[model samples]
Target: MEPDKLPLVQCSLALLAERLTPRDRVSIVGYAGNAGLVLEPTYDKEKVVAALARLEADGSTAGGQGIELAYRFAERNRMEGGINRIFLATDGDFNVGVTDIRALIGMVERERDTGITLTTLGFGSGNYNDAMMEQIADHANGNHAYIDNPREAQKVLEEELSSTLFTSPRT
Candidate 1:
């Protein structure tokens, strides 16, 4: 991943945080080789921002593990009738742990049925797995988007916040 995209991701996150409702619970997970919680699920926007602020770009991406940890955190603090989703923003594919595409998709499909969704935001250009991102989102009952600028980020994270975060009920 290019070193510069971190700032873009952070900028996009700032927009996302600004648009979140006070009742919205958010968890920030940054994964590379090893997955760990950057912030636990919380309703405080400032706390989310602070957690985001602490993120620095490094290591190979262990995206599957990252999503797993994200889901665990979201599941733990899930609200009865509110959005419980994981928004994964990345510049590339899962190159380290649990890197198999089929396995990852299967895992996401199973997790989606558990009631939490996964949205994927692909950033930068080369080495980015657009297909995997979209497929993962589809199976995870969420959305996938490629953001090239602040306007696009605003479109996904702010203008269309509800669609991006809210999972629809089955008929």
Candidate 2:
């Protein structure tokens, strides 16, 4: 993650927290060299927002582990007919482990049958792997977006919250 793009990530997460209702269950995950469960699946907006605030753009990216952890959280607490999704905000760096694009895509693709969508919010420009993010999301039956500013974050997470959160974006 780019240090300069940190605010945009905060704004995006804040927007998401603001838009989530009591019915929605959210799990927050952060990854650098590995993955950490920032929050369990919960309806408490404060917990979710606080977890997002704890994320800092400092360290090597372990995107594969992060996605895997998010999937586990989603799968464990998955609702029968509810929208179970993993919302990844990153600079698209996968340096620490399982960096192979094919392997990462396959990891996510295999989880499609579980019905946990994987939406990626791309941040920053340098070293950003847009194609990989797009392909991962596409294969996981979800959407991909590049959020360059707070406004774009709002447009992606706030304005389109309903559609993006519950249903796949229309191609």
Task: Please report the TM-score between candidate 2 and the true structure.
Answer: 0.91
Report the C-alpha lDDT of model 2 over 63-119, residue by residue, as the tens digit: 999999999999998989888888888875788888898999899888988888899
Candidate 1 structure quality by residue, lDDT tens digits, 30-63: 8966888888767677887888778876658989
Best-performing candidate as measured by TM-score: 2
- Listed in order, each prediction's TM-score against the native is 0.91, 0.91
Highest lDDT scorer: 2
Show where candidate 1 strays beyond 4 Å. 1-4, 164-171
Off by over 4 Å in 2: 1-4, 165-171
- Candidate lDDT scores, in order, read 0.81, 0.82
What residue pairs are clashing in model 1? none
